[model samples]
Target: MNRPPELKRTLKNRHLQLIAIGGAIGTGLFMGSGRTISLAGPSVLFTYIIIGTFLFFVMRAMGELLLHNLQYKSFVDFTTDILNPTIGYYVGWSYWFCWVVIGMADIVAITGYTQFWWPEVPLWLPGIICIIILLTLNLLSVKLFGELEFWFALIKILAILALIGCGGYLLITSFVSTNGIQARISNLWSYGGWMPHGWSGFFAAFQIAIFAFVGIELVGTASAETDDPTTTLPAAINKIPVRVIVFYVLALTIIMTVTPWSMVAPDRSPFVNMFTLIGISAAATIINFVVLTSALSSANSGMYSTGRMLYGLSRNGVGPKVFARLSASGVPQNGLLYSCALLLIGVFLLYAEGDVMKVFTIVTTVSSICFIFVWAVILIAYLRYRRLFPEAHARSVYKMPFGIPMCYVCLIFFAFVLYLFSQDKDTLTGLVATPVWFILLTLFLPLYRQQLKKRISYTDSKHNH
Candidate 1:
């Protein structure tokens, strides 16, 4: 495959590190977690851990493969080279759809976060403006994209760390409040007990718990642009399990401990609610900023991944050739604009009255389904790649753990999660949206494939003539 001429290596290890981390820690962890807790109670922590464990292996497979081939630009390219053109087609475009839906969810969340300050400001305006601002920043340079992700990620990391530290200190100190309450780890099981809500609830939360780990594949999508992807890519992907455990598991454990499983509100952020419980009015402001950064980080990641996917699809003759155009800085301007435009449409959803969140829930469900689809395809690609190119794969170093068996296991598990979504009302959208998205993509792909094939054929015919 020909390299995009204008593409350059500008992103460094730190930028990639922060960008990967940024993508993982966002509105899902900051806000959507409460819903999970409401469903599972104290058992939600275990659900996150299990899903995280599976995702860790997925990232490991991607990291090993990426490290093996320095020239392999993105996971889409990997899919094409390893599997077949059709798999690449589905994975590339589905991944693009994944982020667009996610971007909409994040933008709606931005409107929700802003409601902290101006209750009357109407959600859609802020969501729309936020997309416009991010689009401008993305057009500038890849480094700028990296920088934005870095700082936004930094804020999220700091907030989680601070919240964890505070929760820990309060637990350790056995801090007694002026009121009747005392913060302690004992609160986790004290109210409802470990399985307070019983097996059903514990299992029910699996839908949301898995969704928290949705963007774990993000680093794989941006593999091409990073400097020295071999070392940096592995370093970034290696952090998946740790972040999943710390940011999701440990953080939630703390919230459950301090606030009690029964006390954690379903509608509000556990982070923000904890602070308010501690009588820190100032915490609302701090958490507002953190959530804003979280939203920014989410949008930033959406922009980055969406652009590269476009570039990748174009590379595979699955999208517009113009999308393959890169800036001198190696950033795909057209791709960024395209993704950001969809993100801006999220604002209208935000502004819409009467069950806007229901729409947001629908979007999130669809996004989650899209994410699962891409992930499952990657696993299939890995399975096929290893089988057909055992020699090619063996000659190279990078490989997923448990080899082909892991692929089957992950498939069953992912399929089960999809099933769980159907069983649970909270995650019904994810299940329902899969067919809806599939119908749209199935219809859309034929036209694109035809157009792209024509373009390729025309170029080939011209040369032959």
Candidate 2:
């Protein structure tokens, strides 16, 4: 019998690595970090690292599970095999929704970044252009998509390194005050001392801090397209920690130390604000380019994930049949076009409303919560995998640390994140919308089931009838 329609293994380990980094680092850290730090004070560092650490295990459990079964395909497939097909359908569509929402946020940001170049340019123009460009890149081919994402992500990684280097220079030279805030190590402990806002503030930031790590699982999505899923998967995953430390913790530390939490502008992007504060010539243009690249990376990644998710769903006989079609280049052209068309809606919405952040936040936060749900599924899958294959769990080359206990801890932390969203006003707004979206999805589920069953039953009945 022929194999089910599946994604070809086209992505190399390098492509997978950069895609993961691109997904992990997005418009959030570039622009949103200033707001997060302002809310929680210096303790925001702890917030990022803590959430990052826990998520590392979630990915580890997922990585191990994916490697153990090369046929696992995507998280949806893994969930389907262990759980039920219903859960797979929910998770698959949930992820697609997640990326669509994230694409909107990034497009909104792209328009916002346009202000740096031509203040007179209507935001919608750039937003529309960005959508067009990303859509084209995605529809081209999977390899081209990988290449675009690779460079988009590289720009971000380089930008972070540049900032880190600059910050270190400032700290070492005891850079003099622009805002009467001298550059020094004292910034970490200064101004109301470390946890200035207390544990409540620290925990409160987790509501959205978790959002920063939302796409870290993009690596797993590439499992099917990855060359040597075994070696590449583990290699890509093993670097998650080192990436978090250098890119997240070290970079955040340098930023806070060099600029001081008090000096960072909450209204402006920390990346742009820091460069301007440090007296970089042409700072606005430099940061604008980097932010533009960041936005492009987000949109590009949004397309990649949506395409793969659709492919996975189709293999399970859940999504549109066209999504199962692949081009000679080994890319899923139909899914790419379909997802890109949906993402273009974001550009239109940005045109309609001057303020798209509310829309972006509500949608993206739902996506983040969906990510939490997906992670829980991964852990549950891991726990089940261990039970069935104890030898693999015990002697596996890449096993999750702390096994079941760690899984429980990650689950509790996710629950705590949900609680934090409920308490915070900004996040609570997003939390309120989650149920409504699910209900909208749930209301359509029966019809979806009917249509799905009708098609399958027809296929089977034809042979007998």
Candidate 3:
């Protein structure tokens, strides 16, 4: 008998490593950093560090669980096995929603980045082009998708390293900007203390900071298709903290030190603006290209993830069965097409809202809320695993440090971030809107269970015959 179609383990260690890095560093760092710096001043560095530390533990919990059972494809599967299937349905679909929203955010961000060079181009044009290109690339094969992210991530790493090196030179030389402000390390605190805007601003930064880390758990999703996941997954996950600090904290520190936090443009990319302030027009252009590709990298990742997520859900009977079918190349062609179709809503959003930042802020807020729910479920699943299989937990080489207590700690941290959402106008809209997704899930779950039962009964009948 022929084996049924399945995702091939084509992703190598290098692909997994670069993908983990790519997932952690997003357009949020390149574009949204300006807004975060404006809100918390230099204290934004601490915001990145705190968020990164908590998420590292979350990844640890997920890594240990995924490694414990090589048969598990993703967190959704373990959640169903460790907990109830109902909650698994909720998480599976919610994660798909999270990536869809992020994909839309990337489309909007791409248009914004293009406007840097072509201010007169229609916003919808670039967004459409981005969706088509990403869709075509994704439909080819998983390995090609991995290759694309590998190169895209490499570009981002190079750009940030160059920025840091240039910024350090400016600080040592006490270089003067064309605007007449001198670059100095004191820029961090001289304008205002670390918490320039006080506690309220520091607290407000979490909503956006959390959005910046939205895709960090993607390694969990990619684990199923990874070659020798036991080694690749742990190696990829172990490097998250270092990637977060260097890509986010260190990079932002250099930007704020070179250009005072107060002067940073909330509406523009600080990466490009930092170069512009120093009168390096050519460098600014190059940086713009990097950030542009950064947004494309994120959107491409979204396409890859959402396709796989839908395929997972469908294979389990929680989503449409069509999504379970893979192409000859071992790609989820139907799921990819479905996700790319929805991404067009982004062009509509751009046309309707007419302001890139405004649309980005609203969508990112909703995406962050959804992601928080998904992460909380992962931690809860880990808790369930520990209680159910103490032997497995003890025998596992990749144990989660402070397992039970840390799960509770991560859950509490997620709740605190959710509470922070209500304090702001834009984010409050998202917090209120997020419940609608759960309500819909609750409504459709019964039908899904019924379908699941019918599938099982039919399979039993065929076997008996």
Q: What is the TM-score of each candidate against the true structure?
A: 0.90, 0.91, 0.93
What would the per-residue lDDT of candidate 2 be over residues 99-122, giving only the tens digit for each residue? 888887777778777877788997
Please list the residue runs of candidate 1 whose C-alpha ends up more than 4 Å from where it truly belongs after superposition. Answer: 1-4, 120-124, 277-279, 355-360, 448-465
Off by over 4 Å in 3: 119-123, 277-279, 354-363, 451-465
Q: Which candidate's lDDT is highest?
A: 3
The numbered model that scores best in TM-score is: 3
Q: Name the lDDT of candidate 3.
A: 0.87
- Give candidate 2's whole-model lDDT: 0.79
List, residue by residue over 14-81, the lDDT tens digit for candidate 1: 98888778766656787778888887888888888888887777777777666656677777777766
Which 10-residue span in candidate 1 carries the lowest summed lDDT? 456-465
lDDT of 3 by residue, 229-264 (tens): 999999999999899889998899999888999999
Candidate 3 has its poorest 10 consecutive residues by lDDT at: 456-465
Clashes of each: 1, 0, 0
- N/CA/C clash count, model 2: 0
